[model samples]
Target chain A: MKLFFLLTIFFSFVPILYAQVDTTTLQNNLYDILEDATTDKEGVEYYDLVEYLVQNKIAVNTASIAELMKIPNIDRQSAIAIVRQRNLLGGIKNENDLRSAEGVSEELIDRIISYLIFGDVKDVSFFDSINKNFKAIDFTLRSRGIYDLQQDKAFSDGKYYGSSWKIYNRFVVSKDKNIRVGVLIEKDPGEKSFNDFTTFHFYARDIGFIKNFVAGDFLFEFGHGLTLWSRYSISKGIETVGILPRNGKGIIPYLSSDENMSLRGAAVQFSFNNFNFYTFYSVRNLDGSIDKSTNQITSIRLDGLHRDSSEVAHQRIVNEKLLGISADYSFGEIGSVGLLYYNSTFENDFQHNSLLDPSGNSFDYFAGSYSFTFGKLYFSGETAYNKISLATINSAEIAVDKNFSLLFSYRNYPYDYWSLHSNGFGEKDGTQNESGFYSGFKWRTSYGNIYFYYDQFKYPIGDEKLPLAIKGNEFLIYYSVKPFRDTEFRLRYTNQLKESVAAINGEYGVLSRRKDNLRTELLYKLSKFIQMRSRIELVKTYATAISSEEKGLLLFQDVKYAPTASLSFSGRIVFFQTDSYDSRVYEFENDLTGVMSNPALYGDGMRWYLVARYNTSFGLSLSMKYSELIKPNEKTMGSGDTLINRNVDNRLSFQLDFKF
Target chain B: MNLTIYQLYFWLGADLKFVKDLVFSAAVKKEIGFNPSIRLGTEYSMVDFFKLRIGTSNEPNTYSGGIGIIYQFVQVDYAFFSHPDLGLTHQFGLIIRFTKN
Candidate 1:
C-alpha cells in the first residue's frame, strides 16, 4: 500500500514539474505593464499591450496556480488563493466583478487589466469592436542584385551576381472563409538595374455556396498533369509524384488541400449528386520581364466527374477558347480512360506559311491505364496515342506509347510507400505526375530498402522534317539502407543510351551515345538540428570514332544546420572534372527545305562551385557562392586565345520576404 | 525615429528603387490618423530572399524602400517604408506581422 501511494506521488509530481513557470519572465511582463500604464513617455518600452491582452484571454480564468504565478505580479500564494476563491464563487465576469471576489481587489484588477484580458467577457463592448472575428495573414520576400561580368559566350559563360526574395500570405478570415495573397520581388545584381515583382490572390468558400475561388499566380493540374498542370515549392520537378508546373496568379476552385492545381481568373465549381462540375475563364496578363513570352488568347476550361453511389468519379474537360473538349472516366475493377480533342488557329507561322491564311489544326489523343491487386501481387499497364497536324499539310503525325508493370510480394506488409517504389522515388507531395511504369517493388525493414528499376523516355518526331528527335533508355539497380537511425546510404548503378537525329548532307542522321553512371550518397543526422550529406556521380560516355573517352566524376557535399525554429545554415560544395571543348565547328543544313547551313561548336570545360547560405525567420536570407570554370590543354577557336577563359567568380545575395 | 530607422536601413543597403509618391493626407483628421490611398510599386528579391522595394511612399512621398520577408516561429512579417512627411519624418517604416492560418 505504501509503494502504491509513493508511485501516485511520483506521477503527481511529474505534472507539477511540467507546469512550472519562469518567474523572471513573469516579473518582467509585470513591470512592463505597470510602466506602460503609468507613463506614456517616449523611450519607455511599449509592448503591444493590446495584442498581449488579446493573446492571453483564456488564461486569466482557467489558469492553474503555476500558470497564475506566471502572470507578472501574481505570487504563488495569491495564485492559489485566487483559484480557491474562483472555485467557490464561480468565476469573475468583469473588472468590477473581480473587485468583490475573495483574494481579489480593485487595485489588483487595475494593475492586471492593463496587461491581461478575458476573451469571453461581454460586459464591455470595446473588446468586441476591436476583435470582431479572428483573422490571420501570412507572406515571403526576396531581393537579388546582379553584376554582369563577361558575356561573349552566349551570356551563359558570363559572371553575374544575383539575389531574390519572396513573401506568401494566407488569411484565415473565419473558420470556413480564407483569403491568400503573396508578393515576390527579385533583383539581379549582375544586370546593373533590373527588378521583378509577382503577386497572388485567393479566396476559399468565396460565395458561401458550394464554390471557391483563387486568383493570382497558382498551379493547375489536369489529368495526371500530362497536358495542363501545376506544382509548387515542396517538391523538385520529378514525374513520379504526378506534379505539373507551378504557375502563378490565377483564379481557381478549391477541391481539397491536395487540389493544388490552381488557375488564374474567375473559376466556379458546383457539386450535385456525387457529380462535380467546374468551369473557369482566365486572362493571361502579367508583367512581361518574368518570362520573355506571353499568352494573349482567352481560355475556358470545363470539367465534369461522376460516380455511382460511391464518391469517386470519372472526369472530363474542355479547355481554351480555341481548344474543344476532353473526357476522362474510371471505375473499380475496370479501367481509366481519357480522350482529348482540340482545334485552334495558329497565330504565328513557323517559316514559309502565310500569316494571313492562318493554319487551323485539330489534335486527338487517348490514354488508358489500369491497375489491380491479386493477393500479394499488383499489376498495371498504360497506353497513349496522339495525332496532330495542320489542315494545310493534308497529313497528320501520329505517336503512340505503351507500358506495363508488375510486382509480386508477401501480404505481411513488408514495405513502406517510398520503398515500394524503389529508391528511385524522391519525396512525395501529392502533386507528382506519373509518366509510365517507373518503379519496381521492394521490402522495407528498419535497415531501409533493396530494389531495381527501368526507365525509358522517347520524344519521337511525327514529322520526318522536324529538326529534333530524342530516344533515351535507362536501366538501374540500387540499394538504400539505413544501418542506424541517423544514417542513410544509397548505392546505385545506371546504364543509359541516348539517340538523337541531326541533319547531315541534307539528310537526317542518327547519332547514338551510351554512358554508364555510378552514383552513391550518404546522409547522416548528427543531431536533431544538424544533418550532413555527401554524394558522388561518375559518368563514362562513349562516342565511337570522334571521341572514345568522355568521362568525369562529380562530388558534392552539403551540411544543413538548424539551431532554432527560425534559422538554418547550409553549406555545399560541388566539384567535377570539366570535359574538353571540341574546337571543331560543324555546319548543319536546315532540316526544313535544306536551307543555308549554320555552324556551332560544343565547348568542353569543367566547373566547380561552393555556396553557403543562411536563412532566418525574420524575413531575411543571405548566400555567398564562389565558382570557377576552367579549360585544360586548350584548343583555339580561329585566331583567338587558346580558350575563352572564365576565372573565379564570386557572388553574394540577400533576401527578405513578408506578407500583409 | 521610425522613419529614420527605415531610411537608414535602405541607405545602408544601397537600395536603388525609384518612387513616385511622397505624401498622403486625408481631407479630415481625427484622434487616429486613418485614410485610404492607392500605391503603385516595384520591388526585387535577392538570391537568398532579401527584397529591394521601390515605389510610391505616398501620394506625395516617393521614397525608396528596403524590404524583407521573415517567417520564423510560425509567424510571417513584412518590413517596408514610405516617406517621413507622412509620419516618421525620417526613420519611421512599417512592420506588418501575422499568422496566416
Candidate 2:
C-alpha cells in the first residue's frame, strides 16, 4: 500500500514540475525573432506581408476565403471558393497544401513564397480522406398513361387507351477533386390496349461524352421555348392544343435540364472569347404496320382487334435523318444570345399511295433568342421561322418581363398552300392568312401574380368556294395568390367572341363558333415533402355546324406525398364531360373514335391515377402508376347520343441516370 | 486533410520600415505580406546544375504549368457515364502538371 501511494504521488508531481519548467526563455526567443521579422517590413500591408512570409515558408494558418482574397490577383468569388474548400478540408496543413484547395493556383504559391511561413501546428485524422470524393449507383423507373378521351366509345371503333412503362439504371464513379464518370441503361414494357404496340420507338438517348464531346442521345436547350429541349414534354394543357407548335422529337448538342428521355445525337462544344459554341447531328428511322380505312368519309373499320401485329404490310421507308446546329454567346452582366437552324426531310413508305404529296415534303426551320437583364428587370425574346415548299412564315415574339411590366406581341401566319384548290375536281387556287395582336399587363409581388390581357385574331381566305372569314376577340383575367411559401390559389376567366365576315361570294358568312371558359386551381405545398393540387374548368360553346349548344365541366385533383428523401407517392382524380358527336371540335370523350378517323383531332376524356416513385443519390429513380380512363359508349351509338366506356391500365417503370 | 511544407528564420533583424521611423517613435505597423527573405528548400543537388523559376500571383490559385528543358510533368485522364438506353457518356481531357524551383 505504501509503495502504490508513493508512486501515484510521484507521478502527479512530475506533471506539475514539467509544466513549471521555465518556457519564458523559449517564448522570449520567439518574441525576438518575431520582432526582427516585423521590423523587416513595416509599411507593407499586413496581408501582403503575410503572403510574403507564407511564400517564404515562415508561418502557417488556416486561411479563410476572405483571407485568400487579400492576396494579389485573387477575386472575391475565388476567395469565397477558397474559404469553402478550407472548410471542406477541415484546415490546410501548410501554404503549399493550399494548392489542393479549390482556388489556389501553383503560380500564386510561387509568387507568395518569398514571405510565407509554415509554422502552424495542427491535428490530423483518418476521416479527412473519406470526404475527398463520392461514388454511387443510381436507378429510376417511370410509367405513364397516354390516352385521347374525345373519341366515340363503341367497340366497333378502335380507340387506344393504354399505359407505357420504362425502366432505367445508372452507375457512377467519382474520384479525387474534379473527375467523374457514369453509365446508364433503360427499357420500356408495353401494356395491353385497344391500339396495338406496333411502333414503340425505343433507343439509347444519352450515351456520350460530357464537357467536351458527347456521342449519344442527350437533352438540349437553346432558347426560350425555341429550338430544342427535353423537358418540353410536361407542358401545360394550353400547350397541348395545336394553338402552339408541338415540341419536336429529336436530340442534338445543346443545353437543357432533365436528362432523361431526350433527343439523341453526337455533339461537341468549345469555349472561345468567353463564349461557348456547340453543334450536333441526329438520325432517326421509323417503320410500322399500317391499317387502311375502307372508306374516306364513312364505314371506316380498323382491324387487328386482338392481334399483336399489323394485318397489312406497308411499304418500307428509308431512314429519316435530321440535322441541326446551334451557337450561344454569354458575357457576364451583358446577357446571352443563341441561334439554331435545322433541316429534315419527310419520306413516304409507299411510292404513290398517299392522297397528298407522295414524295412527302421538307421544311427548313430557324430559331433565335436573346435574354438580357437591366437593373431588376429582364428582357427576353425569340423568333422561329419555317419555310415549307413555296410558302414561308415568320413567328416572332418579344417580352419585356420585369416587375410590373407590360407585354405586347403581334403574329402573322400565311398559308401559301391554301392557294392549292382540291375541290376534288381540280386544285383550288387562293392564299389564306391568319394574324393576331395581343397585349397584356402583369403585376408580380413576392406573394403572387396578377395578369390581364386582350387578344384579337383574324383569318382571311381568298378562295371564293371556301368561304372562310372569321374574326375573334378575347379578354382574359388571371390571378394567383400565395398565402404561404408553398401554397397558391389561382383563377382565370376568359371571354371570347367570334363573328363571321364576308364570304368569298360576298354573302353574309354564317356564324361558325363561339366559346367561353372559366378555370380555377388550388395548389398547396405543405412542405418539401407533401403537396396537393386541384383544378376545375367549365366551358360553353355555340356552333352552327352542330344542332345543340354544348356545355361541359372538368374537375381534377392530385396529391403528392414524399415520406423520405428519395421516395414519393402521388394520387390523382379527374372527371370531365363534353358533346359526344363534336369530337372534331371539342374532343371531350373517353373513346378515340374521332381520333381514329382523324388523329389530328384528338378526343378528350376523364382519367384517374395513382403512382409511386423512388430515387437514389447516384441518379437512379423508379415509378409505378395505375390509371382508369372513362370513355363514351359506342355500342349503342345513335345521333346525338352519349357513349359510356371505362378502361383500367397498369404500368411499371424504372430509370437510372448518371452524370460524369 | 491539409498537407503543407514550409520553413522559417529564427534570427533578430530590423525591417526597412522600422529603421526609417525610429527617430519619430512612431508605432510600428507590422506588415503581413511577402518581404525580402532568404529561403532554403529541398532540392536534388546532385542531379541539377541550377534551376530558376518565374511566376505571378493569381490569388487563391495560380497559373502553374511549366515548360521543362530537362524535367516534365504530364497527365492524361478519361471519364465516362453509361446509360441503358444510351450507350456511354464520355469525356477526354489532358492536364500537363508541372512545378519549378
Deviating ranges (above 4 Å) for candidate 1: A1-134, A139-177, A183-200, A206-211, A216-218, A231-264, A285-439, A445-447, A456-472, A503-508, A526-530, A545-547, A563-565, A581-646, B1-101
Give the per-residue lDDT digits (tens) of candidate 2, residues A1-660: 010000010111222110001111222122212221211212112221232224223223544332343342332333444555556766556664666765444433544444333445432222332343234222222222333232334322442222232223333332321222333333222224322222111212111322234555444554533334433222112211111221121222222112222345565655465455666665543333322442111111222122122322321223445567777675444455777777655443323342221223454557776655454333444555554422222222222322354545454445433211110000111112555666666566676666676777776552344446667777777777866556567787766666554333455555656677787766666566666665656677776644448765555555567677677666655545555333222212111100001011112343445555566686544444444443322222122312433232222222232233
The alpha-carbon lDDT assigned to residue A538 of candidate 1 equals 60
CAPRI grade of model 1: incorrect
Interface C-alpha RMSD, model 1: 31.8
Question: Which one wins on lDDT?
Answer: 2
Each candidate: what lDDT?
0.34, 0.38
Q: TM-score per candidate, in order?
A: 0.45, 0.45
For model 1, chain A alone compared with the true chain A gives a TM-score of 0.50
**B1-101 in candidate 2: lDDT tens per residue?**
11111321111111112232111111111111212222111112223322222222222222212222233465443444343445554555566655682
Interface root mean square deviation per prediction: 31.8, 37.0
The stretch of ten residues in a row with the least summed lDDT in candidate 1 chain A is A1-10
